[model samples]
Target: MTTPYPRVELGDLPEIDVFSEEFRAAPWEVTSRIHSPNGLARSSRGIEGLTYQSAHTVLGDRRPRIGFDEMYQATGFDESSPVYQAAVTSINNLEGDVHKVLRETLGRYFTRDFVQTLRPVVRSIAEEILDGFVPGEPVDIATRLVGKIPSRLFASLVGAPLGDAEFLEKTSDALLTVFYMDNANHEVVEKAYAGLAAYVEDLIRVRQSSPGDDVVSYLLDVERSGRITRHDVIVNVTALLRASTDTTAGQMGLVIAELAERPDVWERCHSEPGIIPAAVMEAVRWRTGAWSILRVVREDMNILGTPVPAGTDFFGLAVAAHRDPEAYPDPHTFRLDRRRPKPTLNWGMGVHYCLGKPIAQVEMEEVVRLLTERWTGVHLAKPLVTDGEPVNSRPLTALIGHTPR
Candidate 1:
């Protein structure tokens, strides 16, 4: 039932200053050291937990719980606020049987078969975005080409009309600020959240009268069947929209930057399109999109012979795990032919594995393929940079590039 994780012996791991400016600038260095085969490290944030930079240990063990609701509460948003209420009940935040039922109810829509159905639609969106890219001119790949595709596609998928796609995109960005930005105030974040929720509520009402084959209409059917409440539909749909947008866009930007920087890899992908999928997988592993996830220990257990007490807050350093040399040979090197005989936890693992991974993969692959095909000559025109921390770190922004295809 569990995936095998690389085991490590108990050894000395230095206290990782996750909040330090140096750590922010280059997280992989600290994460790499933390994942040494003989040690485990703690963060300075007073977060009591085990740090597993190895894929086998973190992905294999399913005993820990994702502490989303706990983290939400720490942000001082109680059930009283509409944004807080919506989030706490969301599929992303729910736990136990509730999480299971909601996940099952929504899982069918995200299956490989269903995701495959959207290939034409997703491809068309990519093509439209690419149409705007001028061959010899410099463009901000992170913004003009990469950023809008996922947001627009998500709006279309969730039944938001073409006219509303831009609006939805802006609001979604504002709403997601709560998760990643340090300056995020409840007022600004909640206002953005309320706008999105209200817009979705209106969309739900419209679907109720004129139903269609989109997710909103599907959720309306579930609501009518009495399986879930209206609140569940609204909040979970919000979660889905949020899930499908930002991270995919962020990762796509990173992938494109990688292609631009590594012309050798880009040329290979351009020559043999089939290698693009494998290249995307390696990019996903190399990029470390979803860097870390938290888990609360259910009971006392020995991790690497170290006593981890009950109620301990465990932080799984997924970025570190992806770069663990024990799991991935020459972990820091980026090669298209890197073996992925087993799944990577870049999206995540266990019951909380990303439901929208299919969508993300399709989006990233299509973008890479299209870019390679159309813009044969691509390179970064400016420096590719990231925000300090891995969590909520924007992907290779300022990726202005010249694409002379």
Candidate 2:
């Protein structure tokens, strides 16, 4: 028998709603029409004989025959076409090289041992941000606190000069906007792409002339060894900036919003600092920085009784899955003390899982722990919503005006 197509309404999908007090207290009360297990099956069925559209496929579809029109028709964005083969090839070639170089070059700095050393540094940054807080006035926390810290940290990690922080943040935001926002202004995407490429090219040259103890220097060294090329360095650096900047910053903003809305949960974290990690994990599950990961079926097969054809596009909806009541009891509630043991698909699953999971966890844990310990009575001055464009589902975007005790 032919596969029965899953009929579902997109509007019925559970979105990340931080503004609803009811949602904050009990988010899982809202059922997700599509979730991990069932959503995967639904996506598999939808792509049968149809082209897959989305940002993730932009690089994976290696052939030119997979043109922009087809890509736009399937995915919504014309830029999703793998038009930048040179860039894509360079990135693929350098993935192994960069992973190794990161291990050798900055491994000492980011290791669990060294990360422990940075706790003081992380806390200092947190304090510095809080120091600038004006209790009664509205402030965009994303700009004032969350966005700035990660951008600075990422720049320092890459050995980019302090002056470049603003530029880096702008470029990262522009790039994220290109993918995340609906009707992403084409001009912004092109301008951002060009600006970032120029910046990376310039940085690569500087690092080549004067090597340092940073990832850029490592890339320069590898380029000199002929194992990787200049093209490889630039592309990988772009990917690094995109990955490092947006995801963490976005999640940080979401966590702040969560804490602000649920003072009880924030108090729980304050009383028990050790729960910061679990709180971060739950926040990620609740907001899920990256909404979905796209993968192509290698062969025709059945998943959740849905017949997926070969080359079909399947998406793992992490945000939906994380909210699944079957997995997380009272999935929507911000209950720090909940005894239910639930696995989050926020970082993804299987081999394609995020490589930066450890780093992200560490950064989040430190931020939450320090924020809770240092401040009280934090609340939002504006509505919290998803940034960029709304894709499979909107992810939490920004949080503004955090009051200090």
Candidate 3:
């Protein structure tokens, strides 16, 4: 089989230049430009590796190592190196084991029953935060409110102490920022890994001595039962915090920004209060916190007649796919009434789909519902725009102002 390294002019495609000032100034426009059907076509450089059947052949039921190896290589981590191998093994093991254990271990914490039970607590927290918001003040809602709520909620869910929650949130954000761009410096990754490892190690010991109803405690119990090892516990806990904090915080900011820009949607939610769940899902489809999932072609394949060679890198751009006009008519416009489409592959399509989707949906729905019920005539202080290179949807930078009617 021919190696499918099809060559194309890279500069013709809107560069995925994440750090450009123009991108930072007008992210949504850049996103729209990059994700346009034509833009997507241009962005399809090195796509000789993406065949129609590529999804199945490349990202099948079982996890493949070729993608991990390629990612390591692209990131300058040697695939043959012991550290890279260990990290890959840890990642793969965590993905599979966490999914399986999620039902038994974390299912209760995030279940509909539990979420409904926690609604009052979540609302109380929301109100407390809003009550403290000096009305008419231009707040960095993203950093102040959006990031705080989810981090605290997640920490409570995992039984991490409140103080440590703040530290974990900061570390998680830095780690995610680095990971998302694949630009994490060695020191940054090392520090994050070390800090998180130390924190989890301490939590595991504490939970061992005094088990609680929270997830960490439960996972410790599971480890004791030989269902998982100490290393498994650490990897899964690290995954949970990383997955829960950054994405949720990012989505919260994006949704708030979206609502701020579209007063009609905000007013609808404020008036009805029941449509927030649908709105949250719509926002998720629009923002898509995690941008792309990388896969590797496992064998020779053909996707829509596009040839894919074994071991070639494949990228499924979730944000771009969500905006496909064929998938959603006039995809640019945000419509709450847009017949709640099936959960966009925003989370993912196949076996490697995000494990925390249910929890995220619940958290988003709760936050939106609470915000709508508590405020009216919520208005934006500045025009909300996607101002940055398209990294997962838009990196909702600044919300100049907001008010409660």
Candidate 4:
């Protein structure tokens, strides 16, 4: 950034090694040490905005571009390959007017009416999956029960057979490793992409013949209207399915795990159905860790008075903001009734905020509400095992617990 105003270089600020395991496992341990006056601090590659105001300013600003392609290129993978094509074309990587068009078009389908359509689907799936859990058993409910909920919902979204939900879940898991490049194998990703494409292609054909009031049918209408191509519908719809599969399931597991730890809160949810929504959102914030979007600085700029060079790696840290004492009063205390001065950045802040959030919430709220109602006492059998990747941590990656009445 080439700003005319006097600036404080990032090097002049305190630095935190945000990528370390310590930070990933317990982010507050790292963020708690930060004492920057402007709420912005330096990490190895970029600057992190710790406070709600600073994080919101950086994340909400439309100037900084998300640079997933740069990460893709670092893999030395073929740009024209299936994996590369899908990753680069994802709505997450695009910006400006092109991004706005796809976002708005997709947003059109994710309306309240569409989400309301999923209510019964969420309930039926949740009830059916809950039937698999025995009341007196000590079990890894996160894997055995909660994780399967979203994949099943994904099946409902595209009008696919419920049995195929596992396949969709597996493919979505591999494709999501695109963001976790270190764990990614291009061959596996390519295969996953090819499999998803074939599934989507077949699904598209079926929907064409037997049209229903589903997301795919709506997207097909857009394609037919000449606004987006058939190829666009296929890729974008595949992205949408991926969104529905992993994150929703993982977060739902985390929510259950969190509620288990707080029996008092869990009891409130069991008795007061209206509190389920707030409880679900609070779990999202409390269980979250620091995560940033890689941003491209088109010109030299001063962020919160810190001078960041044009070529530097810049990011907007949203998760960290969730714990900012200034933003969330008594941030560490998991209180559902607490007031929120600002919108939670979990779905992000600007143009790329998650479009699938409504459906995800439906699944979470319904699952939590139903579980609390059906089971009398649900507590953890053991501790949660997380992937511990700060930006993409699954707090309930492995949950083993006992549910005793």
- List TM-scores for all candidates, in order: 0.89, 0.73, 0.79, 0.93
Give me the candidate number with maximum lDDT: 4
Model 3 residue 241 lDDT score: 78
RMSD of 2: 7.0
lDDT of candidate 2?
A: 0.57
Question: Which is the winner by lDDT between candidate 2 and candidate 4?
Answer: 4
Alpha-carbon local distance difference test for all models? 0.70, 0.57, 0.60, 0.76
Clashing pairs in 4: 1-299, 1-300, 1-301, 2-300, 381-401
Q: Judged by lDDT against the true structure, how good is candidate 1?
A: 0.70
lDDT of 1 at 279: 86
Worst 10 residues of 3 by lDDT: 48-57
Q: State the lDDT of candidate 1 residue by residue for 1-405, as single tens digits.
A: 222324432234346776777666656676654543334565554232223333345444667666555555565577677777787778876777988889988996677888878777778888887787676777777777677887788778778866677776677776666664234456666777888888889999899999998988998898899988898888988888777777888878777776777888898998999898888888777766666666666677666545556766666666666666656778778866776535666566777788888888888888787778887767777787765455655564655555556
Answer with 1 or 3, whichever has the higher TM-score: 1
lDDT of 2 at 55: 22
lDDT of 3 by residue, 142-170 (tens): 77777787778777777776667688788
Greater lDDT among 1 and 2 belongs to 1
Worst 10 residues of 2 by lDDT: 48-57
At residue 169, candidate 3 shows an lDDT of 80
